[model samples]
Target: MSAWIAAAGQALLIALLAPIVTGVTRAVRARLEGRAGGRIAQPWRDIRKLLRKPPTSPEGAGVFFSAAPVVLMSTSLLIAATVPFVSTAGIAGSADLIVVVGLLLLGTVALALAGLDTGTAFGGMGSSREMTIAALVEPTLLLAVFALSTRVGTTNLGVIVAAGASDPAAVFTPASLLAFAALAIATLAETARIPVDNPSTHLELTMVHEAMILEYSGRDLALVEWASAMRLAILLGLLANLFAPWGVATGTTWTAVVIAAAVLTVKMCGLATLLAAAEVYAAKLRLFRVPELLAGSFAMALLAVLTSYILA
Candidate 1:
């Protein structure tokens, strides 16, 4: 019963925190660019306004278009609930790496299908680009995490984090450091951040994610945007906890859980701020060159796996 409550609380917390995460990144980026940015609560305001409007589907849009938002939002929520964001004592015990990766991929595919359903030239183009990137990204994400899992002999996320927490020394090895770099790059690409796809860009030529949602409005847009924010937050939280699970509660104690929750929030916001600062110094890569960036990350992941074997 305690575990169930913890899981539910984490999910609800993440859902609420998602917009703030996005807003933080945007605000940081804007400030870095010498512009006064919107408030940290701006994303929340945008989502609320969007929610109050009615969505209009493209003339030929069908079930896929209508279903994609729900599917993406559902998978994001499930991942948020299952991953050990705050308390490792709860649902984190069952958080498998493969399952989390699969859920992430499902959301990606559902959005791609929705993009195709629109039948617009840019929609299909964006879907193609997204799938191409996903092909390169998915492998790197799996292999990078696998590098960390090798030490513990299991791909269970909770076990991996718990093991690292119990033995902090193991988290700083050559394999672990290499895996962290690989996963960080994968996260940037996976979240459609700088040097991958710009969330703020609407230019049809450079848009990958934005193009897919060009046809959506109102409630549908709110869900998609909200889910995207949640995903970014979740990945950052996972990255922070996987390598630095120091504050995560290992027992179902309210005090420990509360402390862990506070730690998780700080980590997520810190990561988002750092990412935004990095983006200020970076530019989006040309479409053709994006694959090269992803390929390099994949190579890093491969090396991490090799290093793990050699060291182990």
Candidate 2:
């Protein structure tokens, strides 16, 4: 019961702090660009303002349009609940890496469908681009998971974390390093960061994810935006905790949990800063160049898998 309570608390924390992570990234980017940024809690204010108003749907849109935000937000919450954050103590089932990947893909598909249901040209184009990226990226994501799972002989994230904890040096290996690189690239692409799709861009021709959600307004927009931020935080948390499983609690020790939380915050901040730096220094890729990015990620993931097999 206590474990379940802890899990629930962590889930809520993830939902709430997700926006802060997004804000931090934005602030870092602003600073890098030599401009003063909004407060770290700016996203919270935006969300609050959004929730106070009713959504306005396009005149011709139907029920699917109304259901889209609910689906998007719900899927993100489900994913957050399933993922092992502070501890694996009370999660309903084993946190399998494949299952995690599948949940994420499911959420992406839901968003894409929502985009298509709107019947807007930009929404359709966004959905098409999103699907194309997903199709190209999934193989790499799976391959990277396969490499790590094969090394630990389990697809369960908790088990993999435990194995790595027992042998910390294992993370320094070439295979793990390569897999991290591949996952990092996939994370950026999946999260719609710069050099992939600029999160802040409103340009119709260049916008991918933003284009799809352009029609969403008020609370619907808030839900979608919050969900995206949560997804980003969850992905970065997984990358940090899974690859570098240091300072994470294994049991219900309060002191250990506190330390773990601190470490988690620090790691997430570093990742957010790094992402901001990348976005600041890089330009968004041409639409046609996206496949090349995915292909490189796929190759690196494949190499990681091969290296793991050879090392074994």
TM-score of 1: 0.98
TM-score of each: 0.98, 0.96
Model 1: number of backbone collisions: 0
- Give the per-residue lDDT digits (tens) of candidate 1, residues 45-155: 999999999999999999999999999999999988888887767674568899999999999999999999999998999899999999999899999988888878899
Candidate 1 least-lDDT 10 residues? 168-177
Give per-residue CA lDDT, model 2, range 1-312, as digits (tens): 366666666778789889999999999999999999998899999999999989998877877778878877887787677566666555722477777788778878878887888899998999999999999877887887677877877788777776677786653367887889888889998899989999998989898999788889999999999999998998898888778877767775667666766787788878998999989889999999999998998999999998988887
Clashing pairs in 1: none
Which runs in model 2 stand beyond 4 Å of their true positions? 170-172
**lDDT, model 2, position 275:** 94
Displacement of the residue 33 alpha carbon in candidate 2, Å = 0.4
